[model samples]
Target: MTVLLRSSTTLAALLLLLPKTFVLGSVKLVMQNGGASQCQTLWAKHTIAVGNVCVEADQRNPEQLIVSYETRDGWKLDDAHLWIGRNISEIPFMADEPADDSKRSVQQQQHQDQPYQKQQQVDLTQFPYKKEDLAGKHENFGFVVKLQHLGYSCPDTQAFVAAAHATVTARSSIRNGNTPTLQSAWASHIEPMKKHVLQGATMINRINQWQDFNFTLVCDIKNDPPEGAPKRHFANQVPK
Candidate 1:
């Protein structure tokens, strides 16, 4: 009777191990551009494996993403500020602060002495909003939001203050329909913010990875006259 009971349990377990089939479907890539797909190529180059799908892109020459759009009234963007961020780790420990010898290991000292540098790359397509969306909270601000790094000089508090002034000036210029020459000029202003105590700059215990800092910036766009401008159409610095 014990042997028979054991046999019955084994059969029940085997029955529970039956195979289940799943329906398979393929999703085609709707290439927005006629040529080879840039997103597909980037995913392939990165080999950033996802679920069961594989993507590929040109390994040698990669295309950059540039943002261009038209407004309802047919206003086209010839050029706009492409927000960028710097990898703060790009700077060497010795370069940021040479006196802190206790923290810089032997390997770090060697690396600091070398001339290796990190490249600055921007992902313009990875924008904050859908490519086609015309209305949103972000749209109201008339500025694009992005993760960017700005360059800064250490031991320079006044430089940081200057950055703030530059940012406000650029935004004001954009609103007034004046031509803004350089995007990096504005980025330089924000560079000091990363080192600013408020941004949380931390040193890693390891030697390979340098300290990392993140920053965000928004573009400004408004044409309405200021409240205090001498002319009704122009807004003066003073509030009306």
Candidate 2:
């Protein structure tokens, strides 16, 4: 009877020591500046064939920011959250871009014509990417978000930054009955991750410690286009 009682106590102790939560796999963040051109340059410099993520200004509309990611085998990008503003705190509360491109163009024009207002006027903008958007393009995929739509105007001399939070899941994790749902996991981790970024935590350090990944890219939007680049035009302006 004594031996059985000891065994029961030992089992209880082990259960107490077990972690309360579990993660199916690692999530990595890779942010490259200057959009596609910058990504290409980094690949050549590092002698790598491809990159995990790329950020670039839209070719037709410089004010629009495009974020691209590479699809990986055996893993799926369950959730991707993005925020952009003068700083980290300002990002989460920024306004979301309109779903329709035409509507966004009109919004941009209105934003430009109006005088600049305080950041508090903008609403919380959710990350724009959805998993279905990447359908069929197994190799890679991308999405665009306009800065003007987010309440940032062009011709402003200040520099702004963008933060991307991606939650990836291993196929095996999904199959495991013990794993928590993606929604629950996101709810548990999002605030803490934001706190880490606000504190200026090193991403490599976090990755080594098996934490969620966060990355940022600095962007400088200028009033004048770069030399030899296409002239800037408003979305509403039609060519004669």
Winner by lDDT: 2
- What's the lDDT for all of these models? 0.23, 0.36
Each prediction's total of clashing residue pairs, residues at least 3 apart in sequence or on different chains, is: 13, 2
Q: What is the TM-score of each candidate against the true structure?
A: 0.18, 0.36
The digit string of per-residue lDDT tens for model 2 on 1-240 reads 000101012234333443333211111112332123223211211222222555555556544556665535444455444454565454434454344434333334345444322223222235444443322224455668765565543112233454443444445555686563322112111233222211222221121111122223221211234459876668999866
Q: Lowest-scoring 10 consecutive residues by lDDT in candidate 1?
A: 159-168
Q: What TM-score would you give candidate 1 relative to the actual structure? A: 0.18
Best by TM-score: 2
- Give the total clashing residue pairs for model 2: 2
- Residue-level error in angstroms, candidate 2, position 226: 15
Candidate 2 Cα errors over 4 Å, as ranges = 1-35, 38-51, 60-63, 93-139, 151-154, 172-240
